[model samples]
Every structure is written in C-alpha cells, then in structure tokens.
Target: MGRTGGKGLSLARRLYTSRILGLVLGLLCVSVAMYPLDPPAWVWAVMLFNGLVWPHLAYQWARRAKVPYHAEHRNLLIDAFLGGFWVAAMHFNPLPSATTISMMAMNNVAIGGARFLLAGAAAQLLGVGVGLVVFAPALVPMTTPAQLYACLPLLMLYPLALGWICFRQAYTLGLHKRELLALSRTDSLTGLLNHGAWKDQLEVEFERCKRQQTGAAIALIDIDHFKAINDTYGHVAGDIVLRQLSKMLKQNLRMADVAGRYGGDEFCVILPDLPLFNAVQAMEALRERFSFLVYEQNPALKVSLSIGLAALDPAQGDATRWLDDADQALYEAKAGGRNRVICCSDDKPRREVFDSV
Candidate 1:
C-alpha cells in the first residue's frame, strides 16, 4: 500500500482494536463482579493490574508513534481498562457495602466522560447502554424501589459527559484532516498546485467545460535556455528564477486562471471560458514581459518562452486531444525558431507532405 493508504489502514486498525478491547474488558469486569467473593483476592488483583496496565501501554505507544492518533480510540481504550480495573479492585475487597456500589458507579462516570468527550451522541448512548449491561446485576435486583430510583442521576450523567467529550474530539479530527489535505495538494516551493493536484483539477475543469459548453484554453510553456542559467549561476539562482517566473505568471493571469509547474522548466495554464485568440494574445504579452525581465548578474542575457495554445472543442468532448494539439504546436514553435506562440492550426501539413514520412 501507499503511504496514505497505510496510514488510513493503521488508523482504522487502532480504532477497531480499541473497540474490541473495550467490549472484552466490559464483559470481563461484569463477569468477575458477578461472582461476589467466590474467588481469591489475588486473582482479582492480578486481573485489575493487567486491565489497567495493558491499555495504558497501548495508549502511550499510540501517543509516541508517528502515526495519526484517533482520540476516540485512545479515550475508549483508557476508560475501558480503568473501568475493568475498578471493578476487579472492588472484587478483591469482598465488602458488600454502599461504598462498593458507589465505586462501581464511579467506574461508569469515568467511562461516560471518555465516551461523551470523544465520540459525541452515539458514544453517549453507547456508554449508557454498556454501563447498564455491566451494572445490571446489582441495580436491577434491588429489593426496594427507592434504591433503583436513586440510580437515575448517575444514569443521566453518563450520557451527558459522553456527548460533550465526543463533540470536542470530532471537531479536532476534522480540523486536522483539512490541514493535511491542503498540505498534500500544495507545492511546497512554488505555492502552486503540485503536478498530481493540478492533473486532478484539470480533469474536473474538463468535465465542467464539456457539460456547460464553456470554452477552455490550455497553454504549454517552457523557459528558454534554463540549463545554461543553472550551469552559469548555480542551483540557488535557478530556483530563484523559477520562483520569480511563477510569481510573474500568477500575477499576469486572470483570477480564474489555473497554473502549475508541469515539470522542471515547464509550466502549464488552464484558462476556463477563454477563446483561442485571447489565449494567444495572453501568451504573447507574457513572452514580451519575460524577455524584458533581467536575470541576476546577467545584464546582456535574453530570456524568451515558446508557448503552444489549444482551445477545447465542445463537439469533440476529448481533453486529451486538446493537450495533444498543444504539444504539436509546441514542437512547431521550437522548429520555426524559439520564443513564439503557435496554435494547432498553424502547424497543418502542406499538400506535398502527404507523400513523405
């Protein structure tokens, strides 16, 4: 799997493991508590120790790891382990007092807090349901109706705490995803769309133009004598030249224009709702501006670009054809002598060319 896919899978595995662990701990706690001092105290103590320490170990590992942390899983696992340990600790005491029951109720409080804080409404309901399942043996069989009535406050408390906790966790996760996506799609050096992101945007724009019957123009641009500049001034100067040219292109284009570095010394622009003639004119102006711009310590140095322009055809409905046409035009511009804009129509074959290879 790719890095992103692996990261996503790891996140899912952690969440699934946490949930299963919670279910197991809940079952273990309730089953152990049901015995009512039938077993040795050391057995219960051992169980408690394992329950508490194991989840803490996992939680700490997740916190330290480079992988993205899912707060819901962390909180749930911690609460589940703690709740199990609390019940086991009570089992070790063998005291059938109100204090024992209160301690069990407090276990529910901790579970509720983790659930509500990290998982929201669904977690609140889940905490209440699971708590009821764990504590049912003690609460449901009470001889007095008043004793059952007194449990209401704790019951309501679980859901409310769970809801609050989960809501905050959800918001934080959302913000993190948004920031990660932006960074992934952006070019770190040029502050433009990266090649992958630019391709995605182009496909979407192509579909939109096809559906809306809107004209779209694409220009393939290359910096003239880029290697000579790099060889003469050093890589740092080359990078500065690229950055300045990117800035100039961005500033010169319309607000709706989308530009990206296709590869080293090559750039592409997607102009939506633009005609072929206007795109040619725009490329001409850009070439003129670039020719006049001075490079560092090279006063006599002249810079020029060769541009190929292609306009989308609604009848054809093929984005690839537009790019192919632009590529042919770019070849023609280079052949006819560098530093000029060439359209697809300008590269048509002569009458006698049909006989030649």
Candidate 2:
C-alpha cells in the first residue's frame, strides 16, 4: 500500500508539472484572443485563477486524496472541462480554440488512451454548451497573424516534452526487462548459470563444435564426501565450501567457459577449443587448489574433488549422448578412488592420479 501511494504521488507530481506548462502558455494565447473585445473584470479574474493557481490546487487535491490515482484522473477531466470553457469564452476564436481543444485531447490520450480521450471530449462539449448558455453563442472563424504566433509555443514545446517523457518510460522498461531475464537465468546461491540454463548452453556449444569441427571438452566435477562435510560441520560450512569452489571456477576458467551448479555438490563446465589432456590438467590444478582452502569454522577440515572429462566426439549423435559420456566418466572417477581425474575417450576410460598434498 505504501509503494502504491508513492507511485500515485509521483504521477500526481508529473501531472502538476505538465499542467503548469500547458496552462501558462494557454493563458497567454487566451489573453491575446480576448484583448480586442475588452472582456469583463470577472473574465480576467477567472483566467488568472485557472492559469496561475489551479495547478497547485489540483496537485494538493490529488496528494491529499485517499486514492491519488483516481483523484489525479478526476483532475485531468477538470482540466478538459476548463479547456472547453476557455474555448467558448474566447467565442471560438479559430487559433486559440483549436489549440486549447487539441492540447486537452493530447493530454487525455496520453493519460488514459482512447477511452479517456472520448470522455474528455464529451466533458469539453458540455462546457461549450454551458458557455453558450452563460455567454453569447458565437464563433469567430478568422484567426489573426498574432493569434497564430501566440499558439506556436504550446504547439511545438508541449508535444516535445510529452514525447521525451514517453521515450524515457520506454527506455526504463527495457532495462527492467533485461535485468529480469538475467536474474531468471542465474543460480540464486552460486550466481552462476543454473542447471537448465547450463544445459541449454551445452546444446549450443555441442552444435558449434560439430559445425566447426573444433576440439572442446566438458567436465562434471563432484565434491567428494560432501554429505559427510555437511553432517560433520553443519550445512553452513558446506555452503561455504560450495561457494569457494564456484569462486575458484570463476577465477580459473576463461571468459568463454560456461560453468554452472549442476545440483547438490556437483558442478559442470564447458571448455571451448580445449583438448581432453589440457582439460584434465586444468581440473587437477583446480582440485589441488580447492583442497588447500582453509575454512574458519573448521581449521582441520579437508575436502577433495572427483572430476570427469570428455572431449567432443565426431561420432556423437547428440548433446544428450555427449552428456552421458561425461556422466560415465564421473562414475569411473568416483569408483577409481575419490580424488582423481578420469577422461572418457571413444574406446575406453583412463584415470589420472595426482599427489593429494
């Protein structure tokens, strides 16, 4: 409710500013039209109140209302009615009358589209009828050169201001849309790509590798004995370990590498243009680095990684088959003892053991 109120207040303030600009210029146009006839003192008083004072009054009315949106909308209708009254009061002087009506119509359309435009038009017609009853029913068809020049400022400047406001709104909405899309694709915990988003990228990488006939490798990394870590040191420490690994992946991989949290204590990486041997060496170095990390919660705690690597095979039918190969290699790594890298080739799986210092 507070947020809604703030939005309403903001809208009311914008409407207030727009009214000030429109009415100030409008007053000049109307004053020029009525000068030759020497209208009554009351007519001048009304014009002064509408041009100089009404914008502030309308703003206060909307700001104080229980629902400012509805109040501001009602204020717009009043603006339309006043515009009609002025047109009739000017005795339908061609330049001022058309300018007044067209500006009100533009305001109505901008605020509430076609429906409000029609509603405002009806209100203006009613004001014209009231004017005919109160003042003389007359229309002056000719517009003097002075009147044409008087209408110029509102005609040129008001539309420009309105267009700028609309463009700003469009640009803001586009930024919000892009932010939402990025959030949707990112993992909440790791700030990396989520599982589904990573799979989508995997398919794209697979297609690229097949088309270009380039060497690329994918690795599935699992934290050995992660469930035991969570059980021994609590989930918070386990979360710390996961975050540290994600940080390492971000720091070690190239900009082109696609890394993601593949559920539980497992992560996935797609290394473009890298051979199986180099990919294994990279994973082994990452594993050794992660093992040396010291946690604040547990000084003696130790962790190790089991990594499975697979190079893109020309004989592979689809991305799913390629993923299955990586998964098979991961199973072999787990089976061949927990802290090692296993590479799956077209013929057989090979294990690489390294010092666990």
Candidate 3:
C-alpha cells in the first residue's frame, strides 16, 4: 500500500495492542474496587465486553474506516468515556478512579497532543454525568488496599510501554533527518560533494590551517578536451569518464582528504596537512590512473586531466584568495599545455612549476 495507508495500519495495530493491555488492567482494578458493593450480573457483562471484546471491535472499526487515524482517535475518546463510566460505577474509589482517568489522558495526549487531550477529558466528563444519572451520584472517597494494589501494574507498566513507543518514533525521525542532510550535501551524478558543499568545506579547511599554522594544499582539476569528447563520442561516454575520475579519486586519496565536483568537467580537492609536492604527486597519480580507463561504448575514446595545486600561504588574506591562487595555476596549466600539473609558488609575480605527464 501507499505510505499513508501503511502508517494508518501501523497506528491501528499499536492502538489495538495498547487497548488490550490497558483494558485488562483497568478491568482488574475496577473489579477489585466494586467487589465489596456486589455489582450486578449486567455490570459484570459490561465489564467483560469493555475489557475483552472492545479492543478487537475497535481494531476492526478503525481498520475498515476511510481514515484509520480519525477512527482510532474516536476509539480513544470512547476509551476515555468508558474509563469515566467505570470510575462512576465504582463510586469514584480514589485509587481505581484516578488510575483509569490518568491512563486515558496520557493516551490522548500521546496520540494527538494537548487539544485532543482536552477533548478526551470533556468526553470523560460527559460519561461521568451519564453514569451519575444511571448509577448512584455519591463518592466513596476512599480506596481499599486491594484496589490500590491492583492499580500498581497499570500505573507502572503502561507508562513504560508508552515511553518506549515515543522513543522509537523519535529515533526513527532522527535517522530520516540525517539521511536527508547527507543527500542535500551530495552530488546526484558523481555521489561526491556538490559545488556549494565543497566550497563550505574549503572555508573550514582554510580556517583550520590558519589557526593551527599547519601546511595544506588545494587542487583544481579539469578534464582535458571534455567538450570535444562529448561532441565526438556522445555525452553518455563523457559521463562515464567523469564517474571513472571520481571513483579513481576516492580510491587514491587518503581518508581525510575532501573531494568534490566543482562543476561540469571540473573537480576540487582539499588535502589537509599535506604539502604542495605531496598534493601534486597524489593528483598526478589520479590523472595517470584515470587516463588508463577504457570505455566500452567507444574503445577509441581517450581522456586526460589537467590539475593545478596551491599550498596554504600566510600571505593569503582569506579562503577566496587561496582559491584564486589555485585558479591562476589552473589557467597556467591549460595555457602551457593540457594533461599537466602546475604548482603556484608564493611570490610577488606568482611563478608556476609545471609537471608534465
């Protein structure tokens, strides 16, 4: 079935189980409270129906309704009403009366919050009024020891069960929230960090390096002749190449390294605590590995990467300046020749050291 239908079914099942447990305990407590008064046979029959048959009837009614949620809510109100009726039948014995009313109130609040809780309380009062007319209106004002002891099980175990259910719901919602956040930050195509998320990480890494006075490097990588590949071999084959490059990066880089797709045919990397030479070596390895990839769609198609490396420099003012340094090096790598790595040196005129493949 659909998600809403499934949720309705689950809620119905939960209500059914809780009703069985609650009614059984409630019947026991009420029976103990009314034993001394010698309740009639019809009263016993009604107790049997409420405690034994009503849970099943409520389940069937809710499951068959157009909206099980609404049906179950009505059933909960009925439970509160019946609890008040029983309280009146027992002449409002202190322990049994309080247990029945409090349990029903807790159920109403748990299911539908404060508004429904108030509504259920109103329903209970209506039942009490009806009982006062049918039965005696007097209050017992005292509970025997047996009635108090009988209420102990419902008071203790019911709350624990309700608390567990609420905790499970909270934990499931937390898991769903975390999954959504991960999807939001990840690229759908490459399964890597998207442009915005990667930029955020770059800023964090920049601040970290500045605070710790440690070395780190950032690289900008572009697929050489990517548009030509797309035109000649089709975009599908170009996508395969991009995915292969991302896979290679994941496999070759250290676990601490952060990588992302900057945009079409371009990627970015943050190598924290790594020197420029080491970053260049790592990028060169990735480039060589990606070059060896053979596409099944077009065996004749070949691709290469041009990467630019820049180390964290004290002279740089902020993360943007560091990114600008890497972009300048990338421009130099493309200008000198494609399929090469260019490292930017910290100097007035910014010298580039080119590493050829």
lDDT of 1 by residue, 1-357 (tens): 213232333444444444344434433434334445354666556455554555555544554444534543445445444443444333322322232233333434444454433433344345445544544333322223333333343344534544554565578789999989988987777777777787787888889988897878888888878899888877877787778778888999999999988788888889889877788778888888887888766676667788877778655456677777777777777676768887754223321010000
Candidate 1: lDDT over CA atoms? Answer: 0.60
Distance from true location, Cα of 257 in model 2, Å: 1.1
lDDT of 2 by residue, 1-357 (tens): 223353478678778878899999999898888887678999999999999999999998888887898888899899888889988888999889999999999999998999999999998998887777878888788888998889999898888887777777688889999989888888888888989999999999999999999889899999999999999999999999999999999999989999999998999999989887788789889989888899888998999998888889899999888888888888888887878777786444454444354
Compared with the true structure, all predictions reach lDDT values of 0.60, 0.87, 0.88
Error of 2 at 39 (Å): 2.8
For model 3 the local lDDT of residue 229 reads: 93
Name the candidate, 1 or 2, with the larger lDDT value.
2
TM-score on alpha carbons, each prediction: 0.58, 0.89, 0.91
The stretch of ten residues in a row with the least summed lDDT in candidate 2 is 346-355
Model 1, TM vs. native:
0.58
**Which of candidates 1 and 3 is the stronger one according to lDDT?**
3
Q: Candidate 1 vs candidate 2: which has greater TM-score? A: 2
Compared with the true structure, what per-residue lDDT tens digits does model 3 show for residues 61-104?
A: 88877788888989999998998888888898888999999999
CA displacement after TM-score superposition, residue 71 of candidate 1 (Å): 14
